[model samples]
Target: VDKDRDPVLGEFFTTESIETCADSIVRESIQNSVDARSGSRPVDVRFSVGCVTKSETGDLFLGLWEHVSVSDEEAGRLCAENGFRYVTVEDFGTTGLRGDPEDVMGDDGDEENEFYFFVRAEGKSPKTGQRGSWGIGKYTYLDVSMINTIFVLTARGGNGPVGGSGPLAIGMAVLKNHKLEGRAYMPDGYLCEVRPLTDGDDDEDAVLPFGPDSDMPEKISAAFNLQRADEPGLSVVVPYVPDELTYEELVRSVARNYGILIGWGDLEVTVVDETGDVATMDSDSILAVLGSLEDNSEREELIDELNLALWGVGLTPGDRTELGRHPLGKHPSWHTDGLMTEEQAKIIRDELAGGRSLAVRVPVPVTEKPDDVTRWSYLDVFFGSSEKKANKPHFYRQGLRISEIPSDTVSGLHALVIIDDEELAGFFGAAEGVSHVNVSSETKSFKGKYAYGANWLKFIKDAPAQILRLARSSEEDEDAGLAEEYFHIPEVEPEPEKEDEPETDPDDTGDIEDPVIPPIKRRVRPYTIAPLVGGGFSVTVNSEVPEGTVLTIDVAYDMPNGNPLKNWAPQDFRLDYMTVEVEGCNLTERSGNRITVASTGESLFKVSVRGFGSNRDLFVDVSLSEDS
Candidate 1:
């Protein structure tokens, strides 16, 4: 089994990967459809749930009952009498799982093999984020199955008309370890077209998605009442669904997660109940569909935001306000443009102050690894303030709402961040933990994928919050006067050789002479540096740093031995973890106990660093990294 295989013990990892399997199903389905769009046409997804008699489907899962049941006798009786319920998700205007049918391994020249990745492989999705985990979204389909089985039908583009010549179908199961004919087998099982093996070695026949383009897949497709009439897309049937998961929840999931997508007119979805009742959601009906859920006990504030806040998306470049662009690898600061021109900043402040909404086009800098050639990527932020209670920030990458990561909150604030950029989305998407909620920088997807992956991740999540703060507040932090005691190097002429003084004896009553103390060297500081409330500090530059002047700041816990820098260690802390706010200069590096910044020719600049633990006193020393 593959190392990253969705474990059978986990019921296809539903417990590990998602908080709500309902949302995961919706998020995954729409994301796949969007990625596989067939040209400029908007994607349409249909979620239909209904009942099917067990006898009608025949021996599809004849032997997996024991493995599927968790006190399922009640389920068996219900199904036998009233028929088992099934969920069929169908997508339109998408090139169905396209690739060589039998390419089990990814050696098929094509960088992306949707067919192989979805049907034949585990943890090898064709649609990982720009730089993310292998396959986080694909497991939901199988996980939704209580019986650990699902049927798939697709029509690749190269094959004639969709339903006519390119249709292919198969069934997959990821179940608990079990025995077949007294022989043990892993949960990864497949139902494919069976034919005579021409290769004499019977063992060479693997559990592949396609053996032949036969009538079996089509027959199963018809039996499941799938609506894919050769329309060129993938349709999946998750049978034996738990009755507790209703079609309405799916509707709420779609609306809650993809409201922005629907508002943008890029997606359309329909949810159908067992009674054939339909709830259609598109650009016009998104709000209308959600209106029905107003009385719902599960209705959340996030869902309510769809109606509460005025939203605006920038389909055109001019619709969005451009913030400062980050020049990755060049500096920790944004492009020389600064966060925004004074006029632009004022406009943003006026909008927020007037209770108006704003959307920003933020250019996120991306790098594959530390200090590599930088590539630019873009993510958008939509924010507004209200008189209502404060709330935490909400983040979405590739159309899915990521719940974890930002724990900080601000009052009367509402913001939605969308990372539609494929590269950054993928990187961050992969960072979403097994719960598939919070974005993490410690994951393998982040560790070596980019330079300062951790820092960039925090910045993106905090961008909207920071922007809101910038617009509403204007005050420099009060500084603790510590420069006089730390940065300056005091010096004095070598103390005159002190005449030896006799030590006082136990019986003597004479007073002892004080020892001669050496004076510290007096060093010069170009600017005043003071400590902030937290472990951070601030630097006030009275004059512009020369073009070639490189400034480096070092911080360490003040040791009683006198020389604080002598025993500094990384195990104690990192500069990046401390809150750093720098303007008029780009922080080039934050490592170990030092922060290096490049001068940006600003005549007067203020730099602040905070968020350090207040328990310990830190000695912050600032100096020039290079000659001016």
Candidate 2:
């Protein structure tokens, strides 16, 4: 860079420029002054323009030249096309000072110096409902001119200090010239140049009367006039206005910026031409614009009402004193004598004793804005005595019932909890067991249908005692189900059987009538049988049966009738020693035995027994088969 720096690059990087446009700076300054003086007192604003012509001498025509311009017309055309030229000067002087003035003050001291031009034109507030009590708005006029000189004249009305003592007029002149060397910029510079025509001062210091014979220009003099008697306000006269600034465009620009004429009843604005023809505007148009700016303002009001209704119940302990009663007068008494049958009083007492259950309903009004479709719009709470005392209550009971009504059937609606135990404690001191709350809505159905009905009971159950203890515990133990647990029973397995001893040698030969049958060992073993009273006998079967093998048994019951029987069905049967079954058993025996059965292969056989009149018995004899 040091070896081959370009002059163009150096100039581009080093250039400095003003941050804001000249017109914006001027408008902002004037707005600041108007805002300062707009509170509690109205201010009148006036504007004037004059064209300056060069004389033979090199001396600049400082009077009219102060407001004239020779710059390019591009900025002016842009400002006019965008409706900037239609601004209302008076409103800008009143409402445009929303920010701090110190940040707007430039090194030129334009804001402070321009204050002298901001004479309180009226002794009352402007038509616009704006609060600006400082006279800082006059600086905007500087945007239209480069001239160092400005002339200001202000006349006070009967409402001012000199009321009915004749109008008090104050005149001031200000000057700024870039070519004038050695002149330091003055922050609060205002010089009195024009005196009352009747002052009889020297002609150089006195302003000539505004007439055809006067040396004063027609344009400058024509702008000065007293507001009509019916007008009942002040007037300002600005001399040496820039020729380039059109009075119509300047008035319109002022209207656009500050014309939200709120709270101003029957206010009027008029501009008089040199021919004395007047053009007028009313404040109603501006009011309409302001109304459009804030469309949802009514909904907010409804919300406020809902909040008030929900929380407006029960007096606090401190509030009891304010109600002309002792704090403990209405306290709950365990003694039965303190309770009475008075219906209204009983309802109150029961509500307090049983704990309060607050329900809120919100309605969706049909409007341009889309309605919220989520379930969160509804709120329900169930307060228990213990939980209430602990300053905590159940919130958002899941099953709260809500019924929505169409907007045609009701007024607009929204709901909110404005106050509750926590909020009351935060705002006022705690009321040990009392919770005061408020909720409001535009809909009556939420209040009439839900709040006054039994629907709330179905949604929120009374808080259990366990929940109260949990709320009061200082420890972090929230396991409420610690005392309850469940267990499952395991299944049992059957025991294995013991093997039996063989009674005869396997090598003994014997005659066998049935060759397919195996040889059997006969043995006698003592057994105990317990006879059941009806007819069934409990028997223990001892055998060397292998595990996992199915077993079958056959038995014959001998009845008192003494008739031989072949089959009998056991009325009731169960195996105590081992599992067994009978096949093809039926009631066939009549006299001696009620049932009988024969074995085919194994010593185990299916058994059956029967008895008369529900009485039955069975016996089986085990012996080696005669055929073997």
Candidate 3:
């Protein structure tokens, strides 16, 4: 039984690493507390750390450990030697534990009593719309304890008879065989044993202390300050904290798990040490906490911005019709009601109605192109930044992120999917236990289908192309696959140059064959428009050339809409070089990579050549002034 239960219980947490145990504890505890909230007020949860020093308690803690410990003699000895460190989590403004005491031993209990089901019930939860849909989170309390013991005390409301007095229960969870008979024989071999009440019957010995009529052990109350007094809530004390887990780790872990809640003023979490209040996570204190941590500095600014954008200044009522345009370009957006593919739109509308669906296209800046692995690291850091490149669509149910397709799983431009509909929740495999999103069945590949439920591969596969077209670069089109497409150039008609001198008749009669007049010609433009590679304009010259006079032509690239291709270096086209060719003119000297042409004995001429450097073999045409 011990061997069978060891591995089974070990697999309860998402991570086995000791560093993340505090994170698990924080996520599970806060989730339960938030779900157990009673009134309209937000939950106030506090995570504090303290030491049980021998000098302060006078061996009371050591004696208590010796009294409760079972099967592990060395663990008990260690507790006596060093008085033990503890982590106490308290949640105020919640309904305290209330339930029948005897129901713990049986299968069914009062449904309204959250306390009995929370601690005693296994594989069942009584709360609705809770973060913890599955009951696996209840195991975290015991798993985080080094000695596998937890001390629970609750103050119920004034409804039932036990509510007026409050109740306290101790449970030590360790995997060991039940012994029928022993020197310290206990019923069912329970590690936790309750002391009998002063005025109670024999049957009430093992039940949790109840009501103002009964008194709690003075040593227990004094050691932990567990007295509820007038307040009604629950307090959990974990004895024998793991040596490796520190208070700093606890604070950061809590921040990572519930920072969204903290930033939005939904909850308040305070970390208290022996000295005083160490740190607090709230809406106003987010910047200070962000600046204090060195590792997540880049992520801090993004979190602050997102929190404000999402929760603080959210979209106003009746504003859903007006779409928000990104600064870069107008990304393509569609709804099930739109006219794009009636059949598909109807399916989407029926399945995910009342949800705002969007596919945004965000271009990658050329400055920060790290290696492939480092690109995905930002997802882990930022977690839920709006610009985070989720290759496949991410699903958000009720403004809370539930499912996301990893970048590596699907390729192409970055896209986002945030749906506010309750109907679409089950379509994305969100009903898979408490993990929310189901893991792929193939352990080796993350790109496989979901473990269970509808994967919707075809629906997500077609969305990127629709959105990617909105921010498509000027270089390529859909079918040609990265081939440059030329932008239309408005034709330039050169006005006939005003001749300075009037026409003169040939001297003495027309004996020189009427001085065969040369027709003015225009050069055919060689290069494609500059907009092909990036943002810019191209010029075409139609100036006439003078007889026997050399003309020098120069061309250069310019950026009109800032530097979009800063990452690309300018290089000469290897296949096609720029040159000047006249129909009836001599190809004269070429200097500084520019062409110099001279009319040699011919009446009419036109110059033609391949485009200049970085023009990608476009044809440029030039005509001389004399030809006009």
Stretches > 4 Å off in candidate 1: 1-19, 63-82, 128-133, 159-165, 196-203, 208-213, 296-311, 315-319, 327-337, 434-436, 473-628
**Alpha carbon lDDT of residue 21, candidate 2?**
31
Q: Is candidate 1 or 3 superior in lDDT?
A: 1
Worst 10 residues of 1 by lDDT: 486-495
RMSD of 3: 18.4
Rank the models by TM-score, top first: 1, 3, 2
Candidate 1 scores a C-alpha RMSD against the true structure in Å of 10.7
Ranking by lDDT: 1, 3, 2
lDDT tens readout by residue for model 1, 1-628: 3333433324335434444567878877787788788878779999998888867887666655544443345433443454688889999988887776655456423544677677666654555563224554566777677665788888666545322336777788776665645777666667775443444356555444542356767667767888888677889898878766688778878887777677678889999999989999888888777667766523555554554333555346775788877654554533233676666667777776677777877778777765586778878877666443445567777666676655334445567777777777866776666445777776655677877777777678767656644553333344435444433322223435445665657897777667666555444456677654324567766677775467777778876676777688877776655455566676678778888787777775666665456677776676665544
Winner by TM-score: 1
Query: Against the true structure, what is every candidate's RMSD?
Result: 10.7, 33.4, 18.4
TM for candidate 3 is 0.55
In model 2, the worst 10-residue window by lDDT is 402-411
Report lDDT (Cα) of residue 199, candidate 2: 31
Q: Largest lDDT belongs to which candidate?
A: 1
Tell me the lDDT of candidate 1: 0.66
TM-score of each: 0.69, 0.26, 0.55
